[model samples]
Target: MKREIFVVADNIFTPLGKTTAENFENLKQGKSAIKQHHNAALSRQPFYAALFDKKEFPKEDRYTKFEQIVIASITDALQQSGLNTSDEKTVFILSSTKGNIGLLETETHTPELFDRISLSASAKLIAEYFGFKNQPIVVSNACISGVVAIITGMRLLRTGQYENAVIAGADVISEFILSGFESFQALSPGVCKPFDKDRDGLNLGEGAGTIILSSNPKYAGNIKALGGGISNDANHISGPSRTGKELSLAIDQAMKDADLSIGDISFISAHGTATSYNDEMEANAIALSGLESVPLNSLKANYGHTLGAAGLIESIVSVQSLKDHVVLPTMGFEERGVTRSVNVAKSIAASSKPNFLKTASGFGGCNAAIVFGK
Candidate 1:
């Protein structure tokens, strides 16, 4: 039989809060981190996003903002897990679409700093800082990077390659990313409204999130990572699949891997990027998986589209909801948007179910689904 993998500890550093608990509290209170920004470097027009303050993170000349947040998040998670980062059996994984990419524009004075622009370089730097024995693994897959990272760690642990895996993901909002999204007209003029008929586009955000998965059940707090699956639409580089068929396959496979059924999932933590295609695509996928009635909420409404950190942070919140037996509302959602009807959580509600599903789809038509249970 495959080894069991459990999520022992996790933390998130975002504009919402510094710790997982703080972020959850703010979420429960219906607070969102998204706001309008006037930074000329980020955008010529006022853009909506969730950004952490400079003072909120340390200023280290050797570390970029991305590195600082990743280190901070993973350190807290490792501390809470009581796992030694230096342990030989502990592996580190970094997930991000853009790691220290901003260094390209700002570090021109130090041409050598150009090397830091590589994702692998940033991961190695972090691994060295924490004294990790293994070479750090970096996952740069579009938006699904976080979930893919977790799935990667789970598979590694199942092979007995590692006893503990520290998976962390983060992506900072930069002028390059902002301009790219603007070019696609994918940026919302205000806070995104997932699954709402009036929803237009997504708001970009930045944050770091870390989740520690271990083979030891003793470290399992209230949730375990049961099974997950990943698939690509191979339809578009930047657009999602026209039909939700590809993503539906991922959801179905994850359920089968976990020995679960539609009735077993009490809620769904959807990607809910609020873009016309993404929301509709996810709706069709959920319906195809026969989970149309499962109550669902999108963290995007609370955190905006955090890109790399989206999956990890959103999964952490889903675990919190399962533990608390409460379903957080789909913030900013007022009307149905997709063709396939879904039970979008309009208000906070109590639930006794023990299992939840988290699904994410990103650029390049990548889709991932992970099943978790308390």
Candidate 2:
């Protein structure tokens, strides 16, 4: 019997705030977290990025700079969830491209030092923090890591393997990731402007987000998984397909799983990376869905591209938009870059009622779509 999963409390550590509500408000107001990085921690990169202030994360674990943020965010989510961690049956799943690569970047000459930054390594560290007994699993699917973790959690719950789960995704800024994007020419010199005529590339941001899920009828979580769909483009490892076929398939599957039709969808949370391929592909997918009137928005402009953490962070933010009854605008959009049949939101509103589709495409020919509603 596949039990249902409901999100009780979700929290995010973003440039916007230490809390999910604050982060959503920032995104709704069209706030951009893509400020220039001025710290001395990163010296090899030439481009600026939206980075978190170290002083703001003193409560985070010191093992790595990112650990601290994830831990703090987890604390907030769990506090809001009112989950009983003492149950011992709760599982932990972490999604991240480079879980603790910050430690590995320093150990390049010593390959064995990779253990220090392994995905499982950091997951164990986080599990211990919550006193969780189960062996935590790590989902390292590049950019799709977060949504993949959520999907994995839903499966576990539906399978009756675990009564509840904590889904956490996080990635911190490091020379390792910075260098990778730089090598790919995916880093924007200034703030990212998604779906804009002159948009260049994505600005990177770091943060962790956690969602607590449970099958218990008593759980107070608002949004349920309803249904989600996932697929890979196979067009390229790093770039998306020209036709957006795979992305379209993912959305179709999710709606099917929910037993919903295209007309049932209200809006979409776009992956809007501000990169030429990402935004174009997403816009085309929305058009193919035949919901051109449905509004679309992106976070790359507000929080930069958070990589793995983006899946959970953005999904959690979507829920906030639903719960808080506010819709944030996409910042940095001046002119439409693509000739698509979709409507791009130019302003934020106090409230909206349409179901939200959170779509994410990543570096490994992987993609995922999650639909949520009140």
Candidate 3:
């Protein structure tokens, strides 16, 4: 039998929640983390984005903002994990789309501050903070990086090499990201409306979620990632296919791993990027999975789009939701769009204890999904 994977402990998600309990409370209350960007700080750009309020963090001019986010997220996750220095059985993995973009900025425009923030530094700082002796694996698979990290951790644990591991994913707002997406014309000017008929584009977000995983019975928890899948469309790097073949295969594989059929899945967490192509592709894929009408929600509705960190944050949310026997609302979904089927928008209630099938597709033809349990 495949060893079971459970989220032993997790901190209150930030930028998404004030604390874990507070966040979970909001999820139970059916409140959403997504909001309109009213801050005039954003340069005159068409795309609005979800920004973490860093004022709550310790005021620091020395470290980059991305570094601050990393520290905050990782420390909180480790604290919740209740891991001591003696817990040598744990491994570490870091995933991000834009690692230390602020550092890259400094390196480009302000060389003096460049030393403090770098991609390797991002990984190193987290590993050093945990005082882990093993080198952490760093993955940057555009948007699917977070789910990839969890899958990698599962493989490691399955190999009987480690008993526990921490998968921490973080990213932050940066000038480069705003400019890059704007250049691609993928940025939305206001709050995103995924699967909505009038949906224009995606609004970027900044935040992170960390999960502590273990096969040991000691770390009992509410949510467990039962299993999931990954597949690439290869039809287009940025645009999704009308057929949604790659994504459908991923869902099928993930269900198989969890030893569940499509009928066993009670709900789904759609990638729902709000872009016309992405949303339509997801709907088509869900229909292809033979889960044409499973209850579904999009974390992008709550967190904007966190890019690489997206999968992990959404996965954590699904775990919490399943555990609480509640479903989060699809915040910005206003109307149905042009798609085949399987676009869910509801404050769902579980008939049989809900197990969420979370799915995502990213740049470079990468797609991933996981089946998580209560």
Candidate 4:
């Protein structure tokens, strides 16, 4: 029999709150952290985002903001799991689209700084802090990094090479990030509205999320990582596939791996970035998978787009939703704007099904899907 992987513990650290429970509570109360900011350091023009107070984290010469959030999230998850990281069977996987990229603003371009900005180096430093015995793995596949990291960890555990996997992802908002999106005109002027008719663009946010997965059955009831699938559209460098068939392929593979039928999935946690193309593409994909009525919601309005941290944070919320037997609404969604029909959640509702699907798409035509269940 294949080894079972369960979510032993998890944590989400964002402007909304520090802990998972706190974040969930804030979501339930319909509170959002996104607001307008006039920070000249990030952008010349005003922008909207969910950002942590600069006072909360003082200038630190040791670790960058990205690393600091990752460490904080992993620490809380480890504490909750009570797992010893010093063991040889425990491994760490770090996910981020941009790690230490902000250092370029202050530091000069030099060969010595190369190693410092490398994602692997950041992963090693974090692993050493927690005393992880094995070499750390790093995933940097655009926005799908977090889900890919989880899937990679699950495969590693199934290979019997590791007993526990500490998966965490984070990215901090910087001038580099904001300007890149701005160049593409992908930033919404105000709050984002996923799957809504008036949805324009995505709002950028910064945060971290950590999930610990173990092969032991002792961690069972919380939820299990049933299966995952990844694919690429090869459509455009920054744009997703126009047809949504690639993402549908990924969703099909995940369901096949999980040994589930369409009816088994209770709902979908979409990667609804509130961007015009992304939300529309996701709707087409769901319809392709015959899941147009699955009742899905995007958490972008609650937390904004956390980039590399989005997949993990959204997955954590999906788990919580399943456990609590409620599906949170897609905030700011009013009318259907996509070409295809979709059951875009408008209000909180009960969910009795044991399984849920999470999907994500990012730059470079990458798409990923994962199924989690009781």
Best by lDDT: 4
lDDT tens digits by residue: candidate 2, 297-326: 787788888888998998888887777766
lDDT against true structure, model 1: 0.91
Q: For model 1, which pairs clash?
A: none
Q: What tens digits encode model 4's per-residue C-alpha lDDT throughout 108-163?
A: 99988888999998998899889998999999999999999999999999899999
lDDT of each: 0.91, 0.80, 0.75, 0.93
Candidate 3 colliding pairs, count: 3
- Expressed as tens digits, the lDDT of each residue in 1-374 for candidate 1 is 77889888999999999899999999999999998888887778888999887686566587888999999998899888888888999999999998877766665646567666889889998999999999889998999999999999999998999999999999998888999999999988899999999999999999999999999767655578889999999899888898899999999989988888888888999999999999999999999999999999998978998899999999999898898999889999999999999999999999999999999999888999999995
Determine which window of 10 residues in candidate 1 has minimal summed lDDT. 103-112
Per-residue lDDT tens digits for candidate 3, residues 1-374, read 88777777765355757446776676666565555554434445334666777576566564466666666766787776677633677788888888776556445655544544556667776677668767778888888898888888877886778888888787887777777787888877777788888888888888777887888866555466677788988788777776888988998888898888776776788888889888888888888888887778786766788877788888877777766676676777777885675646665565465577889898887888888875
lDDT of 3 at 290: 89
- Residue-pair clashes, model 4: 0
Cα lDDT over the full model 3: 0.75
Error of 2 at 208 (Å): 0.6
Runs in model 4 deviating more than 4 A are: none
How do the predictions measure up, each by TM-score?
Answer: 0.97, 0.93, 0.91, 0.99
Error of 4 at 236 (Å): 1.0
